[model samples]
Target chain A: MCLGIPGKIQSIRDDAGLVMGVIDFGGVQRDVCLQYVADEVQVGDYVIVHVGFAITRVDEDEARRTFEVLKEMSQLDELEWMAEAAEQGMRGLEKPA
Target chain B: MKYLSEYRDADIAKRLIGRIKTRATRCWTLMEVCGGQTHTIVRQGLDELLEGSVEMIHGPGCPVCVTPLEQIDKALLIAAKPNVIFTSFGDMLRVPGSDCDLQQVRARGGSVKVVYSPLDALALAQKHPDKEVVFFAVGFETTAPANAMAVFRARQLGVQNFSVLVSHVTVPPAITAILEAPDNRVQGFLAAGHVCAVMGYTEYEPIAAKYKVPIIVTGFEPVDILEGISLAVNQLEERRHEVENQYVRSVRRSGTEPARALVQQVFELANRQWRGIGEIPMSGLRLRDEFAAYDAERKFGVGGLKVTEPAACRAGDVLTGRIKPPQCAAFGTLCTPERPLGAPMVSTEGACSAYYNLAKYRTADPAGAAP
Candidate 1:
């Protein structure tokens, strides 16, 4: 039941009786239930989302720094780079001219 | 550092994907033996980023998906009891039994509550001392400790009204069953890291060696899944089948001793039936004879109830890795999240649910073609 993912808060929308927030992880964006932590969080913050609910917030600077280390650790081989380039090419083609 | 965000970095994920593509020798079939990993892989599109040479298959790690129809029927029986407050994780509410689901029971005026923790059910029992509170405990070893703890807590607190309808299963036995299956397609396994975090990796070493397949204990993150796949692919390419620990940060060779001790004290291994896979010996946990007072099925006389599964549901084949959700006759047609034909299509951690929510679009794609 643990469906937690680290996502950066893109924006928050306040509506009647509910708060909606858009969170982005990599390129996948999801509308997270911010009702749980609406009072404390802000745009540009990072949080752990579980089952569409934002369970807790994570430090944005610390999260970015950790990603940096993971990025370095991932560079342990070259086939990874080739796959990334190919994926990037696909993404480039998908973009509107 | 949260230590969680670092594990999910897309840049790091890309790096791992790059390494996997470079190191591939032949087409390797790696099965992530947990439905949590399946959801993560699909939701993040990690499989789309992997090298075409590596194929990631979903395993039967979903406890709800693998839970037999008889058990769900038993749960419904307990829920139907007057003044009985049947509490379960939200995922179990929609899982269809022989005839109906807990949701249907709720509609019929049964007191069915969805709790985030078993402790909450314990609290409900404390609050309503006059009524009986039965918690439908489900999941693999990952959830066994907590469920066992709830039982122990009830006993300690002298909450006579509280009992657990224990449906806890183990991972190793299921893995062994799958490997022994005649139509087994899994070449290697990404063992559920959370399960190993509780039960440890000691039991898996023998299975890996005996089956001659690599078992990597992996976390539920895109990068973790990629790393697990990379490790498994490397082992398969080199013909070295061994138990590897990619989730070393949380799981140890010897798991939490205190948790295991509590579980052992409360529950005993029993040959239980899986939804689609029939009976596998010593695959499930039941209340020990000593703890029979805390067993809801025995206390309520719901043990002997016989129930039949839906005729068209192919959840058993899907659970054993013999077929994917799309292969099921009812999948995407008669069965869906709203009207699941089986438990797999209903549970959040189910492979069918994972496919339904994340990969149903692929049904229209060319078969065996990469996105």
Candidate 2:
């Protein structure tokens, strides 16, 4: 299971002895069973849900840190690098044997 | 804690998108072979981010969408029995079978329940000892383990009232069928991560080599889909055809061994018919002879219930990626989700349902409505 999708917990309910909650992933909301990881969760906190179950809680600070790194990496233009590498290879081939 | 939150960070996703845009040289057509991935792609508007350079085609990964009309009819038949309590996933309730569905059966005073897991159905049988509980087990390899576990538990508990109407299908065979088709145009594949997690990526290696297509095991998320596409596009650009694992955090080369062994104990490969795709040899699963007592088809003696799909529904074309949802003549006018004329419009994982939910707004414009 891909423990993805950081959904904010809206509310909690006990349905037939099973801990359940309504989780919001942006605008879409779905009912998720929280019995699997109920001991580690709380309201207003974001948790990683997978296959209708909340698997683990995510630290917002950690998420923001990772996003910043990703943004920096995205700025690198691969096409320009590839073109430069190709031109260097062509010059080397022309000068040598 | 999981790799999930890091992978789905929007800032990172935009960065990945920018990286992909810079790397792209030519247009590429990639197909996410799992219906779950299709839903994830649409839900997050991943297509909008890719623009017109990347084409995402839907594949036949939806079990409910591809399950034959006749099998559903047979399930409806079993559910209508006076002492039977039919259990199924909620998505199967509205899938049209001949003239009726599980929802229709419930409306007609039949005992039918929507259960999240087959174990729940087994528990229902245990609690209601007087009634016969037959689970309408329908899914791909991802769901086979849980269903198989339920069967094993039923045998151990000697719960005679419990059984399963298994409609399980395998992934490799479907991929082979799609690649072999004369009209197939899938240049790359985003293999279902969960299916690979259960059955491993070994089966896909041969298919990828034979078809000369890149098969990347992908998770269902916005960034996961983009990363999968980027990987596939890289392979295509480099002319390297191989099976890659983008969801390596969960999937492995051998997959879940215990789960596979459990499935082997309860089920066997058999030639079965798909709704729109016709019959694919040895693609479906059937209960083993020893576990035949828990096979609802044998218990009920309802053979030869095979029925053809409706003439107006082009669900087969939709499943094969030969046509989009709007390409079907009956898509919007006659086959809304509330009044589905076919399985694709009904199941949540279905391509048609995804398009209906996300792309319907875009399709409102006359120029964009042409599929």
Candidate 3:
């Protein structure tokens, strides 16, 4: 029951005094309770849904920091590749400037 | 999946294992205080990878495994009543009570259902106004928020027939009990990351300072577990004890305040009896006096039921890390997953079930090759 999936909110509604939303987890969509994140969540925001409840909103900066920590620990080699690719993309944009 | 799939990468796990090996000055014994962490460690063969570097002992973190037997009996008593629907998480269906479980109760024409959330049980009460809908609320701090919110909503909607049989526990108290034991050998702990996500790491700092053990909040993945182990090992090597967070992406230092407020509004502290371990003060959560009307025990009048565990089951030893699952005499012979002599063998997050299902630590070198 502790297992959670990060899903994007597709839609939200309040019916019979309950805040509910349809969250899309990968390709599957399920209804989730939004009482916990009702103040912060929007229709397009991502959330961590556990046991049919949206427990927390997803943060991009925190996600990036996690990858950076992994990189520092020599765990994520993909982060290095991603950084190199971003640098090349930026160079392409710089030549015109 | 963004934050999760990356942590489970095999290449990352390999690198973290190498780092863990280098950081280990000697064989250090560490206990992960969550059954979810135990399942991940065994299922991914992480323990096998860190064979000689460190020893990972399982702790009493499974809610179903540690739920007092009398609570199960009380749930059974309420479930078998006429015009009542007993709802619980799927894991609780097979957990044995005194003589029968909820699954058997369903087979005998009892109105039992499996719900993913307590809110669903409240919905059931709304649908069937004539029937009583009782939810088996069992978990740690990770689950109390939702359960509390359900009760709060039920009161708002005036859902008279919906109630909860609560068996909520906290992680910090369990850690203290384990450390205070006379035979305790745990040098450090990998605290449950999900619990920390709700209630924060502030409660763990005092425990770490008092017990003189590093408590690291960790997630349920290969890299997370290895990184937490490495952090704890670094502390043990430096002779320092403090609470650290390895699952920084999801968990904050103070946790989610709104969830904490909701839980505090609905529940209060109470002494509770664990299934194998007796009573620990301020370990369990009970519905507050204002929400007492929503308590299944008071509503259904099933409070006096009690049952004793079998003498053959040594779940207490396995829970406290005193012995491995294979060391128990009735482990495979009488306590298989199909017919568990104890709750540990039945719970999906339990250490014994993880070992038995994966066929781990069954070789000539028992105890998962721990020296």
lDDT of candidates 1 onward, in order: 0.74, 0.75, 0.80
Per-residue alpha-carbon lDDT of candidate 3 for residues B1-371, written as tens digits (9 for 90 to 100): 12222443657767788888888888899999888788777766677778887899999998889988889999999999988999887778889888899999999999888776677778778888999999999988878998998899999999999999999988888999989989888999999987888888999999999889999999866678989998998999899999999988778998878889999999999998887888898999999999999999999888776677777889888888888898999998888999998899998778899888667444653544421
TM accuracy, model 1: 0.77
Error of 1 at A48 (Å): 12
Better structure of 1 and 3 per DockQ: 3
**How do all models score by TM-score?**
0.77, 0.78, 0.87
Q: B236, model 1: CA deviation in Å? A: 1.6
C-alpha lDDT of residue B119 in model 3: 76
Give stretches of model 1 more than 4 Å off.
A2-97, B1-8, B359-371
User: Mind giving the per-residue lDDT tens digits that candidate 2 earns over B1-371?
Assistant: 11222344767777777777777787788888788788767656676677665788899888789888878999999999999999876678889988788988999999887664566677779888999999988888866776887788788878999999988898888888988999888899999876886688998998899899999999766677888999998898899999999977556788767667778988999987888989999998999999989989889987567676777999889888889897998887899989999988887678898788665655565343312
Query: What DockQ was computed for model 3?
Result: 0.10
What's the best-to-worst order under lDDT?
Answer: 3, 2, 1
Q: What is candidate 2's lDDT per residue for A1-97, written digit by digit as tens?
A: 1223456777889865557787765444556656545776788877654434454456665334423332322211212222332343311011211
Candidate chain B TM-scores, in order: 0.92, 0.93, 0.93
Report the lDDT tens digits of candidate 1 across residue range B186-257. Answer: 789999876776578999999999999999999876677889998998998899999999987656788656
Error at B340, model 3, angstroms:
1.5
**Chain A: TM-score in each model:** 0.61, 0.60, 0.60
Q: How far is candidate 3 from the true structure (C-alpha RMSD, Å)?
A: 10.0
